[model samples]
Structure formats: C-alpha cells, structure tokens
Target chain A: MNKELVEKIKNDPNYQELVSKRSSFSIKLTIAMLAVYFAFILTIAFKPALLGTPLSADSVTTVGIPVGIAVIIFAFILTGIYTKRANTEFDDLTNKIKNAIKEH
Target chain B: MNRTFLFLVLGSIAVFASGAIEGEVQKQALNMSAIVMFLIFVSATLGITYWAAKRTKSAKDFYTAGGGITGFQNGMAIAGDYMSAASFLGISGLVYMKGYDGLIYSIGFLVGWPIILFMIAEPLRNLGKYTFADVASYRLRQTPIRTLAASGSIATVVLYLIAQMVGAGKLIELLFGLNYEVAVILVGVLMILYVTFGGMLATTWVQIIKAFLLLSGASFMAIAVMAHYDFSFGALFTHATELKGIAIMSPGGLVSDPISAISLAIALMFGTAGLPHILMRFFTVSDAKEARKSVFYATGFIGYFYILTFIIGFGAIVMVFKNPAYLDVVKNAVDGTSPILGGSNMAAIHLSHAVGGDFFLGFISAVAFATILAVVSGLTLAGASAISHDLYASVIKRGNVDSMKEMRVSKIATVILGIVAIIMGIMFEKQNIAFVVGLAFAIAASANFPILVLSMYWRKLTTRGAVVGGSLGLATAILLVILSPTVWVKILGYKTAIFPYEHPALFSVAVAFIAIWFFSITDKSENAKEEQEAFEAQYIRSQTGIGAEGASH
Candidate 1:
C-alpha cells in the first residue's frame, strides 16, 4: 500500500462522499433488481398461475412473457442507469479527491 | 473492429448462400458446408494464437494480457466467455421442448450480470492482481486462503470444463459425423494450445470471435423466424401456442416446487459473481472504470442475446416441432410423436436449416463448437493459474519464485488439465452435462460466493473464519449434491435420496454464512485481531482504488 495515498484518501471529505454516495446508490439499485427478480421467482414458486394468465383477452401471450422481458430489459436499463451516474457523479468526486491530494 | 464485423458478416452470408444450394438436395448426415465453415474458423483462431504467442512473454502478460484490453473488448470477451453451449444450445432446446420454462432459465442467467455490475466488478478490479484469491486473501494469511480459494476454483473449473468438453464431443459427433473420442481430443488439444501458448490473450480473442459468430448466427435465425410470420412477435407467440398448446405460453413442469426453484435461483444469481474465469477477466482491463464499463457492455450484450434466444426458441416450437424433415422417424415409432433428428438440443440447429438451409446449419454448428472451445480455454486458464500462481508460486515458494518459472509451470498445468479434461469428458459423455454444470454452480455459489462477499464487505472476517467457513461450504455443497436426488437416485442408482432436493445452495450457503459469523466473532486470537485491524486498509483500497496493484498507470 502507498502510505501517502492511503492516508490522503482516508482524510478527504470528497473521498467520504464518493464512498457513501456510491455505496448507497449501488445498494439501492441492487435492492431494486433483487425485488423484481425475487418477485418473479416467488411467483414461479407459489402461484405460477399468475404468470400463466394471458396478457390480453384475445392474445395468446402470457403475462410472464412481457414480465420476463421487462426483467431482462430492466437489467440493461439499470446498468445504463448506474453507468450514467458513475461516469459523471462518482468519477468527478474521485478526480477531485485525487487532485486535492496531489496539490497538498 | 469494423473489419472483424465485416469479415463475420461476409463469411456468414457466403455460408448462407452456399447452404441454400446445399439444402436443395436431400439432407446428408455429414454436411460438408459445416465442415468447411468449421475449418475456416479453426484456422482463423489458430492464426490469432500464433500472433498472441509472440507477445505473451511474462507472467503478467500470460495472466492478464498485459492489462492492455479496453472496456469494450473485455466486455465482448466476457460475453464470449459466458455464452456457453448450455446457454445457446441448451436454452433454445428447453424453449423448443417446453415453451415458457426456458425463459425462466434465460432470466436466471441474465439477472446475475446486473448484480455483478452493481456490487462485484469495480472492487474486484481494484483489489485483485491476477486471480479472485488475490482479493480474498488481501487481509488474511495468504497461503491458507490461497490454498482454499484455489481448490474451490479448480473444482469449479474442472467440473465446468468436463461439461463443456462433453457437450463439444456430442455436438461435433452430431454435426460432423465424427467419433466422440476424436471430438473430445480435438477440443481438449485446441484448448491447451490457446492457454499454453497464447495464454489469456489468445483465449480472450477466441472468445470475442466466437461471441461475434454466435450473436450474428442467432440474430439471423431470429430474424428469419420472425420473417416467417411477418416479423411479428405476437404472431410468433400465437403460432407457438397453436402448434403446442395454450399452456406453452407459460411456465411448465421444470421447477418442481418452491424450495428447488428458489435454491436454483440463488445458485444462478450468486454463482456468476464467484466464477473464477469470469472474475479473472476484470484484471485484463486497465482500471476499475474499465471494469465497470465492461459490465455495462456485457449486461447489454448478454440481455440482447437472451432475447434473441427466446425468439429462436419459440421459433423452433413452431418450425421444428412437427417437420418430418428434421424429425427422427424411428423415435416417432416408439412414441407416436415427431421428435427432432437428435434430442431437443438440436432444435436450434434444425431451426437454422428450416430457415437458412444447410450452409447456415453448418455455420451455426461451427459456432457452437467454437463456443465450447472458447469456454474451455477460459476454464483451463483459470485452473492453470490456480495451480501455478496460487499454489506453486504463492503457497510453495512464498512469492519468491521467478516469473518465468511460474509461467512455465502454468503452461505445464494447462497440458495436464487438457489431458484430464479429455478423459473425464469421455467418461461423462453418457451422463447429463446439465446436471454436472449445476453442481459446479452450486459449489461456486455456496462456497466461493459467501467467502468472497464477506471478505470484501465484512470487517470482522478473520483468516480462520474464511478458511473454515469456505471449507465447510465446499464440503457441504459436494456432500449435499451427492445425496441430492440428481446424483443419489439418478447417477448412483438409489431408491431415494438422503437429501430430497435437487440443489444444495439453499442449505450450503446458509451453513457457510453461519460458520463465518460464528468463527469470525468468537475467535479472539492475535491473528484474528490483526486481520480485523487490517480490514481498514483492504476496505480503503477496495473502495478508493488507491494503492491498488497496476493502478499507477
């Protein structure tokens, strides 16, 4: 470990913010995905008849089709959502903290 | 990148056109177009290996490709590494056989990508140098932790390698009319060549190429399938229901009960995060940002690929179900129902023929073989690294060995693994490849995932806790799997299973977590205290990416 960088990162407020914000944000997103995934899995476990219901009165497609697709598409959307925040918010704080340490 | 895509597109079109002409005649058992297409792919990959071998000089280059790969490239390689024969042939076949149940598997496989992205990817890139053990052993005693982690990795990799090798053998024999032993040897030798000579670079490139071919081939099949019904998914679904039944639109008999479904879900979700070969891909990138970006790209590509497979599966239900041309007439004699030429695994292949003809079938068969080769190479490299880097260099020599010597040992380990895989693959050819892969995932999720997550996030985790808990998890998973229905009754010919469930993750993971909590908190040893204090350094490093090895550049 580099003693200087470790100490600097430990003492910086921006570093603290980066850690907290990123952790909370990731945790939130994780919970969201898990909620959807577990809901689907539990439905499959307990009442699969719910998934078996038709999407429309006349349609042959089941509700599970779009629901499953939504789960997958939601994964892509969440990744994009995280990357959008990370590349902007998190990367900015990291660069600021690194620069602050360098100047000192 | 453009050049690679262009070559793939042109090559596929040529195969498609040639296959259309070949499809006009009665279907031959041995399709020459598939053989020629496979030869082209093999020669192309071998050329890449020759080029990569020249640049692979040191241990760093051998293990992590000199950390030169960008995010997009590593993402492609990761997708390539992940989309195994099971995902391609197995998933589509499931969909072809049992309609809505297949999507459940696709969802289970895809959901893990997002979890990995949210939690594991960036920290993993920051903490580890070469292997997942590097991260797990950061605050613990290196030798013991490395030994446990390496054993877990080797077990997972060998099981996965055998499954992939057997799949390749069966697929090749079906497609090219070759012997299973010959096919297994071909796959095994090719994997050893990629790992021993070109190392990670060759394996990554091979995976990327195979990913491209599979995506394109599957995409074409989906498009062709949609075109058959005027490109309407609604029409596709309607036709599928009309052909099979109304119930085909929903979940079927795959998930027996709540316990097994949830247990299988747990294994699939966490297992991806713990797989050694997949985690090792992060180190090939330059930084945590690249690792993060790689996951984003991987999730997008993998999600899209799963959707295409859904379309291909439903397409097969409509197209390949009753078609006599693709059916085995003799099997129909026993059942009075039309079955596909091979088992359900041939659904995607037969669908390709129904849509594009023999050339397209040839192209897909080649891509399937390529998928097996790419996955096996990644598994073999991870296993070799466990033996050489973790066991030989770190444990035996205490990190005092020459880098060149370590690389040499890795190459030798690769050869030995290749031979072992060939033998095990042949022995397990008659066994259920899917069941074997499930055991690998269960061990990984139960043993590796619990320890890895606790080490990264928990401050109280001691060296003893990790070792004891990890071993318990590993042992419990293996024991429970043996006693479970899949192995006990099916494999060992028993009347009833000691453990009634099919999956062991629900029990094994809980045991690991409980043991970790108990051992880590109760132990008051000086070593435990030191490990607890060192967690601050490890946490800061994992979070801020400071003092991370190879991060200076």
Candidate 2:
C-alpha cells in the first residue's frame, strides 16, 4: 500500500468534487420512497379489493399462471434498471475509492 | 376459459405428472425411499455440525468460521443467511396474497442494496469486528455499549430464529404431511448439530448450498413462467394484466404516497447495511476486498431472486384464475376479497403444481424444507456466536481468555438456544410470525446500524457515546415492539391487546440516532485513540480470527 496515494485522495480537489456528488443518492432515495408510498396508496384507493375470490381452494386451479407472467415482465424491467445503475454509477465510484485507498 | 376446460387441464396434468402412476402426493410423499433420502440430507447436515463441534479448537472458529471464507463464498452465504424463511416464503407469499402489495416489499428489499453499495459495505468491512456491537462500543466502554448491542443482536437473532423455526414446523406439516412438533424438533436438532459441530463452517456451507438450491428452484419457475408467454415480454405484461387486472401488473397502491413510502424504504435500505447478521458476513471473509466482492455477488444474486419471487406470486394468481380450481377454494376461504389465494408461501408450491403436477409440487416442497434448514442453521450459529464470543469470552473472561473453554461455552449455548427456539415456535405456531421477524430487522437497523456507521466515520467518538446510543436504541426498539398493537394481537395472536404502533423500526431507529449524538457530546473524557485502536483489533479478529486464518495466523 502506498502512503502517498492516501494523501492524494484526501487532498485532491477532483476526488473531493466526486465525493460531493454523493448527496444525490439521498435525494434519489427520497424519490424512490415516494414512488413506493404513493403507489401503495393509489392502488388501494382505486381498487380497494381484488376483483376476484379470496379462498380459491377446493377448486383445481385457475389463478397463478398469467399473474406470474405479469410479475416476471415487471421484474425483468426492475432488475434491468438496477443492473444498469449498479455498473455505471456504483461500480465506478467504489472502484475509484478502492484505487485511491489501495495506493495508500 | 370455462370451468370444465380449466378443471380438465389441471386434473389431467396433476394425474400425469405424479410419476408414481398413483398420481397422489399425500401417499407417495410418505414412501420409505423418500424418507430415507430425507434422513440422509438431515444426517449430512448433522455430520457437518459434528465436525464443527469437534474442530472447534478456539473461540474464533465458533463465531466467525475462522474468518477465512473467500468473498464469493461469503457473498453467497450472506445472501443465503439473509434470505431466510422470510425472503424465500414470505415475500413470495406477500405477492401471492396482495397482487401488487407484494411488489412493495420486493422493491423495498432489493432497492436497499444500492444504498449499501454506494455507502456502507466497505466502511463496515473496515470497521470494528465480530458483532455490530464491536463497532458501537469502539467509542464507548464494555458495560453498557457492548451489552446493548449484544442484547439487540441476540434478541433480534433469537426472535428471527423463532419465526424461522415455527415457520418450518408448520410448513413441513403442510408440505411433508409430518407431525408439526416432529418437524420443529427435526429442524431444531439438525440446526443445533450444524452449529454445535461444524460451528460457523458447517453453517456457512449449509447457507451457501441453500442459496444455490433456492436460486435454481426460483430460476426454474421463472423459466416455466416465461415459457407460458412464448418468450415475449409484451405478451407477459398483457397476460398478467388480463388475469389479475392491469393494476396487478403495475407497481402502486398504498406505497404511491411519498411520506409513508419513503419512511418504509428508509427502514429497508438502511436496514440492510445495519443488519448484524448480514454485516457479520463481511467479517467472516479474510480481507476487506473479499467483503466488497461478496456484496457485488450478493447484489446480483439477491436482485435476481427478488424478481423471481415477484413472478412466482403473479404466476399463482394467473394459473388459478385461468384454471378456476385453484381460485375456487382460495376465493371462498378469504370471501372473494383476497387474491385467488390463501397464503403467500403457497405461491411457489402452487406454481409448481400448475406447471409440473403433484410430483413437482412435492419436490419444490422438499427444497423449501431444506431452505428452512439452511437458514435456521445460520441463524443459530449467529446466536451462539453472540453468546459464546461477545458475552462469554469478551465480557465474562475479559482480558484473560481460555480458547478451549470458550468453544465449549458456544456449544452449550447452541443447544440452549435451539431448545428455546423450539419452545417459542410451538407457542406461536398459529400466529403470523412475519411481523415478529420484521421487528428483528427494525431493532437491528436502529441499534446496530448507527453504532457501526458512527464508529467507522467519527474518529472522535467516545466510549460513553457508544454505550448510551446502543442502550437507548436497543431499549427503544424493543419496548416499542412489545407495546405495538401488531405484536399484541398478531404475534401470539392473543385476543386482548392495546397500543397501536404497527412499526417500531420507524421510531426506534430515530431514538438511537439522537442518543448516539447526545451521548457522544456528553462523554468528552474517554480516550478516542485508545478506543479506535481497540476497535480495529476487534474488527481484525472478527474478519480474521486470532488463531485461525486472520493475518496473525
């Protein structure tokens, strides 16, 4: 580990500017939270209850298949978004920090 | 689309897929060969436990798997351990019941990873060792700080373990047709063996194995589900909407409201980094780098797993609504108000039957049972570690420690906790234990997270601050949970209850943060340097045990 590398990251203006960008996450988190909370409320307000039955027992089976397909499609989108960001943003910063620290 | 056609599809598939020619699950599930194979799996788990107990050699191995697991293995284990009965059955179960409400928890849980990746993982890997308490107590002394963090960690693990155990018992009875008490005892004994014998090593292996199996099982279901839509993304969304209404395909309802959604996400996102057991996995790895890599792997694995759960939940509703037989009973049970389903855990099982038949259902059930075993084993190891390592060696023996004696204490603690879990699981067999498990996360996020975060960043923190913050956080969370209305009626499902706080995580986490700041300011006399040095040593020990695979080794 290089001691001077630690000094550079601690003092470097460029690195400090990058560090300053972290506050954006806190803001993004707020947005994500709002999306979840408001969505939950709106769904209940509009639908109130499932348009179907509660106890689908005894009956052979008619429920899950199509519903699952829907969820799978939605999940693919969600995961695609997560994978994209994790690589582009998270991986980039984490690697930079490691590089700076390792040199130290 | 008619009743006759739906029944014909389901009934014919159910009969043809059984493979036994008998076409019955209840009958073939109890066969002699299957029983023997089940016993073999149980025995293999016990053998590892036996190995753990014999090779105990030192206190370090008992607590942290000698701190030698590679990042990849540790990552798998972390995902494995953290996934639990809740992640496996609970999330999918939620999706099964609530259409989109299930999506709320999935989004809440998976979205949390970005926070850790951006903020906490590396710092936590670099901070104090062993327990989250080690981080908190870095600035504070042992008496109050360590005790509070330990208490919080222990209480959370114990309650969560009870949920896992009781859930296993009931689930096994339903899936395997075994006696309820017998199933609980079976899992209890296997977990005790896993922890008491192989200690952390056995527990880690079991968790890793469980993670792989769970992932594979979920992937299989996801594939079958995608197949139903002919690999067309557009088709899936449209079909799902057709089955459960367009609302089910979308992500909103109660959570669309910002204030409540943000508050809930706060608990979840921060909660992941804060969780003791999850963070503890970082310590199990040999170095800080390994910890980082593990998180990356865990992020990918867990991300995919959550998506699979969402699909499984939707699948249950679609298969039933289309076939009619599945929805008929569920609709009647919940009075046409609930989804065409009765329980969330059933989502995966029902999906298997819909796609493959009773045989597939039985096999999926077996995997689920194995999942409970893997999770419970990890939880027990965690509990035993807190007791034998933190309390026994650190507190009871203080500076002068006997390695062999500490190992023995861990084994005994393992047995004791296992028994206690069995008793509690049975007591709460009928109650919805998921809420109780959530409380564990609440306390962990509050008491454990702050101490860990502060210790890593604030170089000037004093011992008193750690002590006050941890104690205040732990006490606030537990007290609120005990008094909360949900715990009053839902946990034990008791009829008489008062108090209305459905979420103690929201309040307890707040109090903990305030206490940390207040106490740190008040206690200005403690030596900050000494605390930092001591905390680092503990962290090193946690990541690399004293005699095992740590740097010293």
Local accuracy of candidate 2 as per-residue lDDT tens digits, B286-323: 75456656766776777678778877776766675545
lDDT for B19 in candidate 2 is 11
- Each prediction's fraction of true contacts recovered: 0.76, 0.01
lDDT of 1 by residue, B458-503 (tens): 9999988898999999999899878876668766889998987777
The parts of candidate 2 lying over 4 Å away from their true place are: A1-104, B1-37, B47-56, B256-259, B322-344, B431-434, B488-501, B526-553
Model 2 RMSD to the real structure?
8.8
In candidate 1 chain B, what residue range of length 10 has the lowest lDDT sum?
B15-24
TM-score of each candidate structure, all chains considered together: 0.94, 0.77
True contacts kept of 1: 0.76
Reference-based lDDT, each prediction: 0.83, 0.61
